[model samples]
Target: MTPTTAFKVLTGEQMAALEKDGSFAGAPVDLADGYIHLSTFEQLTETVDKHFAGHDDLHVVEVDLEALGDAVKWEESRGGQLFPHLYGPLTLDVVVAYGPLHRDGTGQVQRPITG
Candidate 1:
């Protein structure tokens, strides 16, 4: 994935719920924060390492920002970097692709196939 292709990390249950509901309002932390958190490809590994360390059945969802329109906002976050935050519900229509998250030999999450 490249920085141009934003992505969201989700738990299995969250993904399942999203699939069933047709739209994802927000995850637990996202609801608490009042916005959905999204990371660029460059930020993925660190985001997972910091927030999803022991998580199982994780999924990396590639999203089409254009489909989200103005609902997506880029704001300053960790390390003063601007991260994409969604102020509205995430519809399945914006999802380009998604699959289970795996780990590499170093115990870090493997990069998702973007092309």
Candidate 2:
């Protein structure tokens, strides 16, 4: 079953831009790919380790997939896993929670706290 919520990893600069603009077109890779890449909670840690590693100023944005409706597509990616791809600008209104990416003592990525 596909999860209804997923995470978008962004740099501090990207997060700031999203805040300032109210909507984010996407990061460079997202622009090239023509969609914003998102990962389910299960995929978050590896996504961070693989793509976002070595970056300290990273943030995890929890988004409501249902809120995006048809704009979100589930497509095959890394290891044939189904990942969510947003076909439109990611508006801040759809964000349920967001914060700096943190890890637990066991080295697992911790989900952001909801404010």
Candidate 3:
């Protein structure tokens, strides 16, 4: 089966549970020092799917923040195959920098505090 994509970011508590449960198929995973970094989508999906089960109505999307231009552009542009049409349009709200940012934070090398 084709590997699924990441719909949204996850919490540290959720990440820890996935790792302990072996839901990632023993792939390399890490959630250290208040940051999460994975090598591939397969690893990411394995963790995300465990918690995301039973939400079949929701479509999982993996968005590239850089390619989509700024937040305003994302809000205005039409979504692709990843996003569900019911969402109409998408809006990206970037949070403030807090503490030390990690290399893979929010698809960029910046810490995000999305509320």
lDDT of 2 by residue, 69-98 (tens): 999999999999889999999999999999
* Span of 10 residues, lowest total lDDT, candidate 2: 106-115
After superposition, the stretches of candidate 1 with alpha carbons farther than 4 Å from their true spots are: 104-115
Residue 102's C-alpha lDDT in candidate 2? 92
Best-matching candidate per TM-score? 2
Q: Give one digit per residue, the lDDT tens place, for model 3 in 1-115.
A: 4222223333444434433552321112322212122212333344344544543332222333333233212112122222211111222221111222223534333223322
Each model's TM-score? Answer: 0.88, 0.96, 0.24
Candidate 1 lDDT over 42-85, as tens digits, reads 78889999999888889988888877878888999999989999
For candidate 1, what is the lDDT? 0.85
Which order, best to worst by TM-score? 2, 1, 3
RMSD from true fold, candidate 3: 15.9
* Ranked candidates (lDDT, high to low): 2, 1, 3
Error of 2 at 11 (Å): 0.4
Whole-model Cα lDDT per candidate? Answer: 0.85, 0.92, 0.29
